[model samples]
Target chain A: MARIDLVDLAHAYRPNPTTDADYALRPMNTSWRQGGAYALLGPSGCGKTTLLNIISGLVVPSRGHVLFDGVDVTRLATEKRNIAQVFQFPVIYDTMTVRENLAFPLRNRGMPAAAVAARVGEIAELLDLNVDLDRRARALTPDAKQKISLGRGLVRSDVAAILFDEPLTVIDPALKWELRSKLKALHRALDLTMIYVTHDQTEALTFADTVVVMHDGAIVQMGRPNELFERPEHTFVGHFIGSPGMNVLPAKVEGRTADVGGVPIALGRSYSAIPPGRKIEIGIRPEYVRLSSGEGVPVRVERIDDLGRIRFAKVRLGDARLSVVAPPGVRLEDDRSRVSFDPAQIHVYADSRRIEGDA
Target chain B: MDKPINNAAWFLILPAFAIVLFNAVIPMMTVVNYSVQDSFGNNQFFWNGLGWFQELLDPSSELGGRFFASLGRSALFSAIVLAVQVPLGIAVALSMPRSGIALALCLVFIAMPLLIPWNVVGTMWQLYSRSDIGLLGWTVNAIGIPFNYTNSVLAAWTVLVLMDTWHWTGLIALLCYAGLKSIPDAYYQAARIDGASRWAVFTRIELPKLRSVLLIGVLLRFMDSFMIYTEPFVVTGGGPGSVTTFLSIDLVKIALGQFDLGKAGAMSIVYTLIILAVCWVFYTVMVTPENKGARE
Candidate 1:
């Protein structure tokens, strides 16, 4: 695995950036290991694509360096970066046949003709495009064109890394899973360094080994997919990376006891540092909260949505509307219900920053 | 994509058909009528079946020499215009900025000459090429050379070719620009990844994609140059022993100036047929079966 280091990389499209707020990508340092499949996940207008472009050398960083294998490539053009990129839309040459589209890069690099054909043959088969090798790219469906685009990047086995920029955004939803699975399989088989950028959490979680969560222009957190799901370091990370997102409630804290909406909540684990502050908020995933017939915080259940596999209890705890996921076997009770949460599953925050003290 | 064919489609299409009939088909029919019948005065007419067509096609007649010479001249003029314009337009389009105010500025400047009325373009060049008052002719005359376009075959051809280029190159450039603009940023990305040179990117990604527009541009330029008039008439008046006389000039000379309506009509039909035939050949050869739906 090659080590990629970004040393204080910052970018601003404007001529003069007067402050950190002016930067489109806030200056930061981070490294991704070689052979790691990492996803940069964030909403639109966030710096995920910007960061991906920076790494791919499509955009020169306004400040600092991008080191690949400990060599600075910050000033290098994208052509010299040796990185493959799949764009949001399929970019295969429409005039070329499916095989020609896949073989273009290899032929450009002066690969032997036999080898180019052999590799194109392999990639086409992997993408299930073998039968259409002789068919012109123009005659294919949108998904087929995308497969050619994918194969064009992957056909060159010598690329240092593959950078995917929302490659599946144009795909129909039904085909998204099939393509994602193909990408995941390709990554496993090739063991190439791949960096994917997407706003969809399911895509990010399914394809990448490590997930990098970004907000505004800065990276909020980076960890394994399960690590991100289980223990998000930043409040934005928890909120941005999950379905229905994590429910955040304003809270107050002192010593061992955490008061959320002026109701006492227990913490099973202790922390060395939770700074007492104003603007504190409590974060919890909707699936983590439990609604049972046991004694706990009293709440009035306003609505229950019974989805096929689970039920969502939209409960009123004081002025807050909170939802708890019930497993398939349990039926949610009346308007008045008691809601309880696993104390160890709790993550408390103060002033938008996660409290380090008690879980 | 399927729709049932209905007679109601004719109701929707009738106005369009009427417009074409009024504007194009009727004029063509008039040319056909004149081709067969002789016109003596405003009211008198006589049937001269194939009489003028025979004379125009005969090597012994002056009409034959003029017809052949004009055909050769028109072909050469069209060839030179295409050779000069398409590449020049593509180059200008390539060199322009891709976005922002700079792109708008380039577009406005390129579009400036195309907006000038055709006859105004002819008039402008007419004045600009005069030995007495025109700057270019005056400068040439001061350099100790006679620079009268009305009398010099070289000067006449230069003025006509340059004027046509100046007036119409913008159209080609705009068309090529549209073709260039429609290319997704992705192909460039793929090229960049492929380590393609600038020339390679242009040839492999840009030019092949521009094939359809190039086809249109060439056909359009050919049709326009072959039928060209007005500008040459204003500037050279087909002088200097008819060195710059294209077929349209001779057609106008025959029908209107000499009142040889039958021969002129026959020549006009022949000229139109020649233009249609050449353009059809170009279109078929350049853009037929192989490249149909070549681009998605």
Candidate 2:
């Protein structure tokens, strides 16, 4: 096991990249500690897979070095780097039996035949592939094939890390949950450094202790799951993490008060000397917004979605349309509605970035 | 309650059936009819019954021994062609460029020989292998080896095999290249991650994926070689004293050269049955259990 560090890493598919747009992954520095489970979450084309490939040594960054345990391995090939990766599609040796498929990596690394067999047996049992061990990998279901892919990675004891690139995408929906929980359990049992790349928020939130949210070739935030939902550092994270996401409203701030449309609201903390051209907005989660009577901004209730546990009220306050999650027992006054933001849940942003100290 | 059976669905197959009947069935039926009887001029066919078949099967008979000799020769030619071409084609395909202008150039070059007419290929090789004027023959002789394809049986056989390989190996290579290209890059990436050696990657991943396409290559080459005629017939003309007379050339000689229609027809029927049985056996053996689903 090793700690993977990306030092000022950036990549471009083109030979000569003169502009930021030419780069697939923007320059950034981050380190994944040994034995930590991390998720790199982003939308499509957000460079999450590029980052994973860089860490796995499948890709060499144009401008920075990848260090594993402080050893420069930027130019090392994947085999020499000793990293294992499970692709989106299950990649198994179709001609080989499941036992051979699981034993491949071990044998490739020059392990003894007896040890390879023992390790293959252990992993096959762990993956519930014991019964199909003698069958050809091509005849198995997709989920079973994926389990062989996982077992191939797991069988190698000296692997630096295991990387998963949307490995559950091809699995049946019912089996996705089971595979994900099994993966989480494996991480806990093995305590290997695993970096999972995915676009699904639920998968990331459920699997990783730390979620790294990326946007437009750069990481926007890196925090615990709850931290990302409650205190998103960027507007992209605020809008991406939650089910309906956090609602961001334009506001003008001066001193300790901010104007939401025409109505002035008191800030949770005082601010001094505000800049003129910087964009300012206040964000509140739908779960934290409440129906108010006397204070808060006035809104008109547009629609209400009655989910089993929570009722989501879609309300409009002037030019901004917002969604407020209300409990099943709470009723919204249909025509004229006022929603209040919780002081602790109210997050302020300037120019799309959270105003850390000001908040 | 029984659902109505639409007999119209059976009629939907008529066009394909009609095409097959006009192209294959009629010609095959004529051969079968000729096989069972003797035709003496004036379109009069005498009921020979199994007379021609019995003669062809008896080893002591002239036609029987000649037919067996040519059949064995044809089998050997096909075996040699397959042995050389399959591996050679796979090697070329593996080394071919993956993309860019180089790949386009390679594809165009490989397809050139296959596009040439069969008779043209024959005539070209006939002149090309002449020791007096041909570059190949003159060079080999100039190197102090007495080489004359028309005179020596070994040289004739070698020239025939070489010419066939030159003409058709490209087809096999092209098919294999296409199969290799269809494989996604992820498989290779995963193999690299698993620390598989180059040989392991080829045997475990690439070879397995290529099984179906290679079977096609084998089937095409096998049938073409088994029925080979025009190229060798034009170049050697069954010359060098019957040394290069394959089954098809022998059949043509009997049917046209000697006008022995009954014997030629019998030989043709046996040849067709042999080819069909071999191809069916190969196709069945090569297809994996999992691939059965894809075939359906």
Candidate 3:
């Protein structure tokens, strides 16, 4: 386990990064504790892979430092950085057998042949790839190839950190949950510092202990998985981290209450540093939005989605529509519907940044 | 069994196949027929069996030794061409930018040699290797090195070798460059993350992927070099004492110049077999399941 420190790292694809827009990765300063499993989650062009590449030393930062175990290694190459990385697709040599593919790095490092073989066998068994020890890598299917890639990255327990950049993207949906669980198990067994970057929020939240949410080249917030979902600090985090994302309704804040679409809702607490007489929005996750009769916004039920475990009643209020999660068998029985939510669960945001909250 | 006769498509292929049969297959068959028989004059012939093959097989006598010497020269020429061109071609391919003005400039330069006719290239080098007027020859002579292809076998071989390299290295480089360009940038990115040394990336990735293209390059170069006649013939004219006379040049000398049709035909069959066999072996080794797409 190693404490990773990234001090003011910024990257730009273009030679001259004149403005903030020119940078693919906005300036970031963050750190991770030893033996922590972390994930950088974002949309496709949100600089998640770029940040991963920068950390793996595949991309050089235009400014600032990256220190692993307090050693300044910003200028060092990937080979000198002492980190293992797995690509989005499997990157094994097609000519070599699975065994040879696993043994290549160890042999290149001048590890003992016996030790190399033993480790290769162990990783092969872990990946359920022992039967393919002598089979050519080219002959394997896409899923098998990805397993080899995952195994290769995890094979070396001696590396300071292991980085993965969307390694499970090529995997099938049915196998994704199983593989993600396996990765979590591997991290627990080895205690290696692992950093995973993915665009899928579910993948990040479920697999990582801490999820770092990035948006438009900047990290909006970083916290534990539950913290990200329960209290998203930024609007982007709220929309990004959950399925049937948190509903953000445009409202005007008046002291401790918000008047949303001619309906009054109490915030139950005052927010400091944010002046009242401005356009403010209230955000609440669907799970926290309690739907009942005649207590909240006057809206018409557009449709109802039955997901078996819970029902999502999509209601249109003024110009915006909000999804409210109801208990199973709850259906929209009326055209004109009234659904309400707890005021404590509501998060206030002025612009895209969250207003100061106790959460 | 009922078979459909598609006469409409047949019309398109009939003319092309007829032309090939007349120009290529018939001539080859005539050679094959001549190889097994004794051709006297005006199509007068007698059966000769394997006597011609027997004569070339034993290299003790003068004709036998000449046959072996020409074969050896052909092999050496091919070896030299492979040695100079494959690495040089790969280096040039690697250096070429994938797109834009730099690639355009590279394309223009690579196309220059390809545009020159084989005989013209030989003639160009022949004049360019003169001790009096040519820059290379004049420089060498002025620097106190006696450089004359008319006399020195080494000088003639050097001139012809350089001419061949100039004629075909561009083709090899272009083929390899196409293959290299087809490789995804992801492979390089993966290599970077894997912390591969430059040589390892090149050896494990680039070179292995280049296998198919390089096979085609080698086969084309080998066939061209083996059957080479025009360029070397025009430059050195088989040299003083036949030092640069390749098998093709020797076959032409026997069949057309000296009118030994039977021997030339036999040697032609042998040459074709050698090329076919070698190329088949190359295709098999490179495109096999274990070795195929090894780089990917």
Candidate 4:
């Protein structure tokens, strides 16, 4: 395994990109530590796959260097880079048995027959494919085929990293959880630096130690799952991560108070040095915003979603809509209720980017 | 709920059935009628009752000996054509550019020969291989190989095979190209990641993916070449001797040239049955294993 570094890496499918919009992946520098599991999480067309492809050497970046363990491999072919990639769809040699499918990479590298067999046996056992080892790959279900694809990558011990590009896309939903857990177990057992690209937030949060949240061709935040949940560096991350996502509402901030549509809300920290003529907003998680009968900012309850164990109130304060967690014992007599935000959980934003305030 | 039975739906296909009856079934019945009777001129037929079929099947009889010889020749020609065309077509397909203006140009060029009329192809090759005025025969003879298709059986066979290859290898190549196109880019990317060699990629991935399309190409080429008559008849006239007299040519010579309707009809039935049997066997052998695996 090797540490992969992207030094000012950027890519554009077009000839010469002049604007940020022209680039598929914006210029950025980041390092993935060896033996760490990282997930590149974003929505469709968010350049997560582009970044993963760049790391795998499938697409050469329009600018910048890819350094694997501090050696420049920017122009290297995928085979020479010692990287393995499992694509969105399972790719297997249909004519070959599962044993031969797993053995392919090892044999291609000229590994001895005994060693190939041993490695194949190990991988088949690890993937629970030992029983179907002699069966042709064409006859297997999609999940089994995907397991063989993963086993092919795992059988080779010298791979620098294993990249997964939404590899569970074609799997049945019931099997997605099982295969996902199996992958996490594989990462722990093999200790290989794995980069998984996915659009699903749950998959990313569950699989990676560090999740890199991307939006509009740029990485918005790179942190642990909880770090992303608690503090989003950019407004996009705040709006993209959580289940209902963090609520971002336009407001006017001055000193230790913010005004949302003429309704004043208290802030825990002061932002006296706020820049002139910029879009100001405040973000808070629905979990931290409690709906109650106590004295707070008055809101009109639009609807209440009863989610089995908990309920969330979709409320409107003046003109701004917000989602607030409704307390289990509290009941709204009418469509009106009071919603309070925990001061510490409130984050201030300027021009769609988070800004620090003096405590 | 009980399902509605729709027996009336069968009437909807009557138009198609009528078309087939007129175009195929009626003509085949006439041939069958001719096969079972002896006919002299004036459309007068007498009951022959398997006399022609029995004679055609007996190798000691004149018609039987001629029929067997021509059948063997046609089968051999088909085998040679398949052996040469399939691999060459695959190679051409593999070498084609994946995309861009060049790919469009290559597709059009490969499709040119297939677009020509069959009789036109026969006539073109007939003139193109003439020793006196043709470029191919004249150039070969100029290069110190005494090649004349009219007089030499080997030369005639070579010309016939080459003409057929030139006229039809494009069909196989185009089919193979289409098959190759249907393969996802992920397979090649995965193969590269696996460090597979070029030959390994072709054999393990491409060839297996191409099996279904190649089956279609083989069957089409086999039936077309097995029933081949026009080009060889145009070029050799089954000549110098009976060297290139394939089944169709021999049958035509009997039915039209000599007007022996009974013998010709029997030969035609046997020839068609042979083709149908071979196709059935080939299709079963190739498709059954994969279908069995699929069912499991």
Candidate 5:
């Protein structure tokens, strides 16, 4: 396993990109620790695939260098870079049996036949594919074929890293969980650096130790799953993560309090200097916002969504819509209610970037 | 839910049935009638009682000897062309550009030969391989190869095979190119990341994906070459001691040149049965679920 360092890496499909909008992946510096389970999480066309491709050496960056274990491998071809990738769809050799498919990468590198067989057996057992070792890859189900695709990468012992570009896209819904758990188990057994790219928050949150959230063409936040949940680094991350996502409302902030549509709310931290002419906002998770009897900012309850375990009220605070947790047995008077935000959970954003405040 | 049954839907197939009957059934019945009877001048006929069939099956008889010889020649010609063209076509397909104006131009050039009319292809090859005036024949003779397609059996077979290859290999190449186009870019990327060599990638990824198209190419080429008549007939004229006279040419000679209606009709039926049987075997072997599952 090797630590992957992206030194100011950026890429654009066209030559001579003159603006940030032209780049598929904007310039950024990041390092993935060896054996770390990381997820590159983003929506479609957000450049997650472009960044993954750059890491796997499928696409060379337009600027900067990719270093593996401190060795610069910016221009190295995919085969020379010693990385493995599983695609959005299962890409198995159709004519080969499961055992042969697993052994392919090893055989391609001229590994000894005995060693290849041993590794293939280990991978098949790990993937729970021992019963299908002799079956043709084309005859298996999609999930089984996807396991074979994963096995091909895992069979190579010297592989530096493994990249997955939404590998579970084609799997059945029931099998997605089973396969995901199997991947988690595999990660525990084999301490290889794995980069999983996906748009699903649940997949990213559960599968990754660290979720690198990308927005537009750049990484907005990279932190532990809980860190992302408790404190999203940017407004995009706050809006993108969680079920209802973080409720962001335009506000005016002064010293120790913020006014949301002219209603003052307490702030846990105090700001000394407010940036001039910047759009100010406050982000709070729906879990932190609660419906109160009469003590907090008044809102109109638009609708109550019962998610079986807990209820959430979609409420309107002045002109801004907000989602707040509705306590069981709490009745609203004519759909007019008040919601209180846990001041510690409140994060202030200045022009979409999180701004730190002092106590 | 119970479904309603309508007999009126059956009428939709009448036009197709009529077309098949007029094109296939009526002509086949006429041949069957001729096969069972002897015909003389002025359409005079006498019942032969399968005498032509009996004579045609016996190797010592003139009709049987000529029929078996031509059948063997046709089979050999089919084998030779298929063996040469399939590999050459695959190579040509692999070398073709993936996309751009160059790729479009390349496809157009590759498809040019297939668009030519059969008679034109035949006439063109006939003149193209003349030893005295043609580019190919004159070049070979100038290189001290002593090639004369009109008098030499070897030269006649060579020109016939070359002409057939040139006229049809493009069909196989285009089919293979289409198959190649359907393969996703992810397969190649996966293969590369798996440390696969160029040859390994072609064999393990590309060749397997091209299997269905290759089957079509092989089937079409085999059938076309087996029943080949126009090009070879025009160029070799089944001459040079009857070496290049295939089954179709022999059947034409018996039916038209010698006017032996009974023998020619019987031969025609047998030739058609052979082609049908071969096609059945090909379809069954290549497309059966068991075979498809095993191969794919």
Candidate 6:
């Protein structure tokens, strides 16, 4: 397997892209360490799939090079690049038997028949497709067909990487977890470099060792799932990584104290270098915002959503709405309430970029 | 427990029943009646139950031999047309532009042949194959080949087959094109990732996906060409000693030209049964699991 590198990769669907808006993938450089499971997580049309396609050689980047273990393969066709990819939908060969479907990739490369059959048998057993090996692919259910798609990719032993483009979108909800755990198991067993693209945060967080959070066409942060959750380098990552997301309140910062809305709050870290004209905001995850009795920002509780284990209280301070997690049986009786933020959990952002501060 | 029945639903089906009665049932019954009886002048009829069918099926009889010979010709014509049209149609469909203004233009031009009426097509080919004045005949003659559709059996058969091909290959190609368009882009991408060659992609992915539509095309072509009468009738008129006369033309010649209604009716029933049997066999074979599983 090869360590993949994207050097200054940028792609545009249209010819002659002169601005960032015209590019599907804005200029950026990133690399995937050998044998690491990474997830490119983003909202729809954020160019995660474009980046995956570039890596798979399905689409050439408009202005960058893709190197596999330091070899420039920018102009190589997908067949020559030795990559495997599973698409968003199940794409099994409808006419072939399940066994033959698994053997297709190896046979296409002119592998010996015995080797192909052995590989097919191995992948079929791994995917629980042994009994249905002789069945027509069209007759199986969607999940089974998707398993065949995975099997086809896994059948090839020498592929540099296997890229997945939202492969579980069509799976049943209950089976999604089973297949995801199976994928994680397969990663551990085979130790193949894998890159999964998805918009669902849970899928990204649970499957990837490192999650690359993207917005608009550029990566906002790339770190371990917990790092992305704890210390988001961009406001987009802070707002996108968690359940109910992070609450961002506009702030006026000077030295170590800040005024949020109308109340002056003590800063946990210094933001003295932040200029006066720049827009400054304080970000805190919903998990860290707590209800207080005496000292905190005054808020009007609007609604409380009970989520079985934890509840989210929607509160408003001035015109901004913020979510605070309340324990199982907390009551919100009065219209006015006080909520406090943990100093270590607070993040400062100026112009959507996380400003440097002491943790 | 007795179930409550809604008799009013019967009223809703009355229109369809009446249409079928006038369109299909009446003519079928009349044909059955004609097949079982002999008719003379002045509305006089005699009961001849099974006599015409017996004569038509008996190979030793003159009418039976004629019927068998014409049926063989019809089968051969259909086989040749299908063999030529299906592959050619698939190739043309594969070469067609996928999108943009060129796709629309290609579709319109390909559909032009199918839009021409059957009789008009027949008459056009009749004049177009004239050895003295027609472009094709004159060109062949200029190239040192004596081609006269009126006098040579080979020339007449070629013109007949060529005319039919030109008239109907477009329909098959259009059906195949629709099938090709329905396949998603993901299949091609997956094939590319799997390192499949161009031929592998076509045989494994494109051809298999086109199976159902190709079945439809084959069935339609077989049945239509088996009963073909119009174009050949107008252009060749079973010329050069009946070499190009197909089943429908022979049936017409027997019933209308020779006034043998009972025999013709029997032949017509037999022809329809043959077509139905072949179509059923084709449909079953095309959709069976064995055929699907046989691919690798």
Model 2 chain B worst lDDT window (10 residues): B287-296
Q: CA shift at B33, candidate 4, in angstroms?
A: 1.7
DockQ of each: 0.52, 0.59, 0.31, 0.77, 0.62, 0.57
Q: Give the TM-score of candidate 5.
A: 0.96
Every candidate's fraction of true contacts kept comes to 0.63, 0.75, 0.31, 0.79, 0.79, 0.75
Q: Which stretches of candidate 3 lie over 4 Å from their true place?
A: A271-273, A276-279, A290-295, A306-310, A326-333, A357-359, B1-24, B33-68, B95-104, B189-195, B260-262, B289-296
- Quality of candidate 1's docking, in CAPRI categories? medium
On residues A214-324, what C-alpha lDDT tens digit does candidate 4 reach at each position? Answer: 998999899999999999988888888987889999999999989999988888899999989999999999999988777788888887789898888789899989988
After superposing candidate 5 on the true structure, give the runs of residues whose Cα lies further than 4 Å from its correct spot: A330-333, B1-12, B288-296
Chain A TM-score for model 2, please? Answer: 0.96
TM-score of chain B of each: 0.88, 0.93, 0.89, 0.96, 0.94, 0.95
**Candidate 6 chain B worst ten-residue window by lDDT:** B287-296
lDDT per residue for candidate 4 within B1-296, as digits (tens), equals: 99999899999999999999999999999999999999999989999999999999998999899998998889889999999999999999999999999999999999999888777887888888889999988999999999898899899999899989998999999999999999999999999999999999999999988999998999999999999988888888898699999999999999999999998888889889999999998898888878876776
Poorest 10 consecutive residues by lDDT, candidate 2 chain A: A327-336
What docking grade does candidate 6 earn?
medium
Off by over 4 Å in 4: A329-333, B3-12
Better of 4 and 5 by TM-score: 4
Ranking by DockQ: 4, 5, 2, 6, 1, 3
How do the residues A1-359 of candidate 1 rate in per-residue lDDT, one tens digit apiece?
35689999889988789987788899889998889999999999888888888888878988999999999999888877778888888887766788888888888788899998899999998999999999888788888888888898888887778889999988999999999999999999998889999999999998998998888899888889888877777778888877656777876655556677789877656654655445777777878888765768888877778776667878888888887785454454554457887777777776666766634
lDDT of 1 by residue, B240-293 (tens): 788887888888888889998788889988887887899889999987645565
Clashes of 2: 0
| lDDT per residue as tens, model 2, A1-359 | 99988899999989899988999999999999999999999999999999989888888889999999999999999989989899999999988889999999888889999999998988888889999998888788999999999999888877789999999999999999999999999899888999999999999999999999999999999999999998999999999999889999899877677778876767676666656799999888898888655557778888888886778988888788888985455455556568787777777789998885454
Deviation of model 5 at A299, angstroms: 1.4
lDDT tens digits, residue span B1-296, model 5: 99999999999999999999999999999999999899999989999978999988888998899999999999999999999999999999999998999999999999999999888898887888888998888989999999999999899999999988888999999999999999999999998998888898889888988888988998999899999998878888898879999999999999999999999999999999999898888777776754766565
TM-score of each: 0.92, 0.96, 0.89, 0.97, 0.96, 0.97
Residue B37, model 5: Cα distance from true site in angstroms: 1.3
Candidate 5 - chain A - TM: 0.98
Interface RMSD of each: 3.0, 3.4, 4.3, 1.2, 2.4, 4.0
